[model samples]
Target: MTKSNFQILLADDDEDDCMFFKDALDELSLSATLKTVRNGVELMDFLENNLSNLPQVLFLDLNMPRKSGTECLLEIKESEKLRRLPVIIYSTSSNLEVMDMLYCKGAQYYIRKPADFADLKFVINRTISLLKEKNVQHPTREEFVIQT
Candidate 1:
């Protein structure tokens, strides 16, 4: 899809965070459409059902209930149909080990959820730009985690 009409899917449990994310996207004035799921189970179901019409990017939260983002990421990578879809780990966790594991598991990038709305917008915009420029190619370890 074109940059003006980017499709984004977000798997996050917190209502406040979701609101903030949507608000940030709105404030940024990018013509991006966002779809959100409450947990990993829903996220997987959505992806499975929309195999032919997948989003340009998935912003996945790590600490969801029922099914964790790690499980979802593994399943996505294992699936032939979903393997190429870009997944950005949007989480609060800054644990290096977890980030490393996620990067190894095929996540396109890791973003520690920014506290400020401006930073959030910046990271999201930067991520979209990177995905557009890189075409989902795995970056080096040094560039795996995006710090805002």
Candidate 2:
């Protein structure tokens, strides 16, 4: 897909944070379809239904109302159909234990959520640019977006 024709799915429990992300995405003109899942369970349900046309990337949060980011990442990694898409854990805290667990569980990347709006915009822009500039070394095979 082209730069202006990309999709990004973000999973977070907080409404305010999601709204901020939506604004940041719009400001960047990333042209992504931002799907918001309330918790890990809903995320799986969405993925189960949308795996055929999975989003190009996913940004997830650590703490949620129901299932956690760790659970969601594990489920996605184990899935045959939805394992290729990239998953980034966007959380507020930088706990070493959580970070290590997520990395071991197959998360593509771990990003500390930005407190400032401008910083959030910068992070999102960098993320989009990274996706846009990624080199597909093995183009034929479908590959997961490894964010770490």
Candidate 3:
């Protein structure tokens, strides 16, 4: 298959946050598509069913109904088919212990959801830049958590 644009998946239950993310991507003027799942179950279902169309990266919210982001991350890393996919923890929580566990479990990055639209745009832009550069597949411990 010929893929011309970047594919991004976001698993966030918050409707407002989801809208903000899509809006941010629209404002970036980048060649990328954003697909969203409201919860962890849907996120895993999409990933598991769409083996041929797996997204280049996944932005997961740590808090959600049903399975949480941490649970999804663990499952993703455990599955051979999904282990290589980059999972970014995008959440409002900044618990150091939780962040450290996620990093150790193979999440590519952890982004604390920014309150401002501008900050959200900046974070998304930075994420896309890293994806393009392909330098952060295995970032250092110091660079694991992205700060606004």
Candidate 4:
């Protein structure tokens, strides 16, 4: 995709993780504008910032300082306008219960974060590819008219 058509919402607290992801995204040559939120509260505030601006994809970390990603996902799923948006639970923990909970919370995918940098990059690449396929397989955007 062209840079003009790329956009992603990344909700993560760790700056290092974000930097690592940025490098991976660059390596993949994905033309995406990543919007970062440090915590769940910030993410919620962003959704309400502009009714017209909505991201096509959301990458949420399971743990955060103020609020949790699971809570954030629940809120997003509860919203009629946001339910259709693809949400991926990208977390460091490999806990089965957390994964199951995230799935039940309406996450399209639950991915365990890789330990090494190379593995993490690979995980990001695979997730991006899978999401691209899923988007094509089932196209459903909310009628709420959000910006790209």
Candidate 5:
């Protein structure tokens, strides 16, 4: 697919992580268009205002200033217009308890941010590939987290 074919949204407060994510995407040459929102508030605003062009998937960081990913997740899932949108929890923490909660709350997947650039690319690739499958849906507990 071309860059315009795959649209992705990322909501994270970390400047460095956003840069790293874009860099990994560049290195992979996967033709994915990524839009970054610094925090959950911005993410929600974008999502609400851009109803005509909703992203194919959202990569959300669990912690952010102003509003948290948990809050955003809840809001998104509660919205009839946004509930079907796939959300991938991209966070630094690997707290299984929190992950379980997020799953029950309706997030499609949880991905622990990879420290290595190559691993990050791999994880992103895997995620995009998996999402392309017709049968792709909320994963089982054992398959929820994308371990790169």
Candidate 6:
């Protein structure tokens, strides 16, 4: 993916959170494309149908209506076609155990939803930077949880 055309897919059920994320991306002025899916089912369908053009990164929320992000992560990791996709767990829960579980489940990063808009921007920018620098490689446990 080109630096100016980063593709991002966000799976979130919360309308306000999704709006906030989009607003943050707009404010950052990064030449990125953002596509959002409201639930895990749609997320999976989108990924499956767009196999030839997968996003550069996926920001997935843990809680959803039909399917959970945890289930989606496991499915993605298990699928050969989608196994390499970079997934960043984006949720409000910062529980160490849950983070550890997600890391072990093959998530590239974990980001606790920031309450402040500035912090949200910072974390999002940092995440994009890391993706560019690391080439979507799985980071160490210590580096997995990104904090603002």
Best by lDDT: 6
Which has the better lDDT: candidate 3, or candidate 6? Answer: 6
Decoy 4 TM-score against native: 0.83
- Which of 4 and 6 is the better model by lDDT? 6
Measured with C-alpha atoms, the lDDT of residue 18 in candidate 3 is 98
Question: Tens digit of lDDT per residue, candidate 6, span 1-148?
Answer: 6868799999999999999999999889689999999999999999999999999999999999899999999999999999999999999997899999999999999999998999999999999999989988899999999998
lDDT of 2 by residue, 40-140 (tens): 88988899988678888889997986788888888898988877777778998777787776776776666788878888888888766666676412221
Tell me how far the alpha carbon of residue 14 in candidate 6 is from the true structure, in angstroms, after superposition.
0.2
* Candidate scoring better on TM-score of 1 and 3: 1
lDDT score for candidate 2 against the true structure? 0.77
- Residue-level error in angstroms, candidate 3, position 35: 0.7
lDDT of 3 by residue, 31-147 (tens): 788899999899899999999989889999999889999999999999999998999999999889998899999999889999999999999988777766775478887988777
Give each model's clash number.
0, 2, 0, 1, 0, 0
Question: How many clashing residue pairs, candidate 4?
Answer: 1
On lDDT, the stronger of 1 and 3 is: 1
Q: Pick by TM-score: which candidate is best?
A: 6
Task: Quote each prediction's TM-score.
Answer: 0.97, 0.86, 0.95, 0.83, 0.95, 0.98
Kindly indicate the candidate among 4 and 6 with the higher TM-score: 6
By the TM-score metric, which is better: model 1 or model 2?
A: 1
Ranking by lDDT: 6, 1, 5, 3, 2, 4
Write the residue-wise lDDT of candidate 1 on 32-51 in tens digits: 99999999999999999999
Which residue pairs overlap in candidate 5's backbone?
A: none
Model 3 misplacement above 4 A: 1-4
Clashes of 5: 0
